[model samples]
Target: MSSDLFDRIAAIGVIPVIAIENAAQAVSLADALLEGGLPLAEITFRTTAAAEVMATLRDKRPELLVGAGTILDSASLDAAKASGALFGLAPGYDAEIVAEAGRIGLPFAPGIMTPSELGAALKQGARLCKFFPAGTAGGPAALAGISTPFAHLGCRFIPTGGVTEANLPDWLAVKDVLAVGGTWIATTSDIANGRWAEIAAKTRAAVARVREARGG
Candidate 1:
């Protein structure tokens, strides 16, 4: 992982997890997020339009930091890199996938909910990982406990599942957390209905939450 890119992510504090079905909305979505004062997007690879959407953003909205998500294998990781994604993430830890990411030079954050998974990530030299199903996995409390043993080893996290504007503070309060991924920021309906303004509003609120959480 590039230190500069990681720093940029840490600065943003809130990353929008985007999955747009229509490629036509790509640039407009970028515009909305930028308008909201947030310049980051994690385009999930689950949708067929993921790569195209990312490429469109890269060419048309170069200011937005685009990343790939839901990457389950090396093939998707390669596609994400080819699409010009700055980073990539998955919902679960896979040794092969982690190794492939290191080999391909794309900064990847594998998901973990237990110390065993965290150990796996560290063994592969990954300091930053994702805390998935966060709400059901005990949210901030779970992360705080699971990350304690590895905090001194330079471990960091980005808690995603169930993270939202409501509890943004609680999540960011953890010493090991670097950011929170807001799946609620840009939902499928929001994107499909072309609700750019609503998405932007939600994004702006999230940005505000991050600022408030950090006492900025």
Candidate 2:
């Protein structure tokens, strides 16, 4: 994995995990994020428009660090790669998927909830991970607890699911967290209405929160 990939993601502070219902909205939504000072987005493959959106965003806004999320199998991985995703994210760690990602030279952030899962991800050469359902997984406290013993393992995490502006501070304050993921900034209505200005405002608020939490 290239160290620059992690550095790019970390620089953004927050990675918006977006699920686009309409492929047409992808480019505009990405532009809004960038306009608001964010330069990264993780477009999840949960919708039929995922691949199309990835392609559109890559061509229209190549500067954004685009990642494919909800990638569970090799086929999905291949499709995401073909669509120009710079990285891949899985809801849970699968050895096969992780191996395939590495083979294809794509940086991956697999999900893990327990120490055992984290160990498995590490064995697969994954130093960065996603703590899914982060709030239910005990949120920041859970990450802090795991870091106490496994911080020496050189593992870092991006807390995704359930992350909101309210708890982003607590999550980012944790030493083990590299970044956070959420869709609150790019709501469906904002995209539908072409509310780029509104989206940018929300994004600015989120970024400000991240900076405040980091004491910057």
Candidate 3:
């Protein structure tokens, strides 16, 4: 399951970390992403409407790989699952949450920055992780430094936060990077102001860069 999600995400090479302010924007956002050659979204739990957004995308645009992010505990994971999220993501590692997700058969990815955290996730049998706040975490340089020890390992990374079209290629150039996460494609202001065309254009540019970087 992890490999399948990894392949799908890598194919597009970007995961839009979306924070939808209203459920009404969900379907249109999914359509915009599809039009831009990207169909993956992590509807963050930062807002009250996240789950609704996730469910709307799932039911309206079944082809989109919709999931829940900012998942901090088992309850949040359960809520995400109930909302039809195919997977769950968190910003930090928690053994209890991971255990619960495993017991429930949910494919999960915990956030990791330090080598210690990476080792811990590996011990927990997690092959993919989110390198959150990727820019503040040293961006591609930080990823390269930490990935050195686990170069032979099969672990892959999804660097989120601070990712942009200008620097996305840098992250994709890394050996173990599967995909990148960013809010630039569809910012809160963009959605609030109903700027779907701007979002679609940005998605196209991001996808183009990913294809160029992967030599696809």
Candidate 4:
């Protein structure tokens, strides 16, 4: 089931990292993403409305591939699963949390910044991971560099943090990158001001970049 979700994400080649301040925007946000040719969203646990937004989307826009982000512990993990998030992610790796995810069967991708962190995650059999704060961490060049040692390990990544459309292709160009976490697709201000069209436009532009990078 996790492999299917990951395959869908790779086919789209982008995951809109959304932080919703209000749950009421879920339907409109889903519509905007769909309008722009995107069907994936990572509802981050950065605000109080995260769970509600996920639940609303789960009930209203069932077609969208919704996942949970910033999942720091077992409690948040349980809440995310209950809210119908098909997958989960975090800013960093935690062994206990990863174990808990496996125990519950939630498709999870823990974050890894350093080789050691990546090693730790790989040690526990996690290949799909997040290269957090990608911009500060050297973007594609750095990811490509760190991933060299683990090339034979079947490591894949979802490069998040500071991932703008400008660098979206660069991130996608790396072989290890499955898809990018695009926070710019629909930012807080965009949703807050109900700029659905702008959100759709950004989503479309991101989709275009992914297609262009993949030579589609």
* TM agreement with the true structure for every prediction: 0.98, 0.96, 0.96, 0.98
lDDT tens digits by residue: candidate 4, 1-216: 377787888899999998999998899999999999999999999998999999999999999999999999888899899999999999899999888998988988999999999999999878789999889899899999999999999989999998988888889889879999978899999999999999999989989988998898
Poorest 10 consecutive residues of model 3 by lDDT? 1-10
Best by TM-score: 1
lDDT of each: 0.92, 0.88, 0.87, 0.92
What does candidate 3's lDDT look like per residue over 1-216, in tens digits? 367776887787888898888999998888888898888888999888998898887788999998799999777888898888988888888888888888887888899989999999888888888998789899899999998898787888899988988988899999889889888998888988888898899889988988888787
Clashes of each: 0, 0, 0, 0
Give model 4's clash tally. Answer: 0
Off by over 4 Å in 3: none
TM-score for predicted model 1 compared with the true structure: 0.98
What would the C-alpha RMSD of candidate 4 be, to one decimal place? 0.9
Clashing pairs in 3: none
Clashing pairs in 4: none
Q: Write the residue-wise lDDT of candidate 2 on 1-216 in tens digits.
A: 468988778766798888888998888898899889998989898888999999998899999889999999998899899999998898898999999999998889899989888989998899889898788899899888876778888888999889999889988889968899998988777787899999999999999988898888
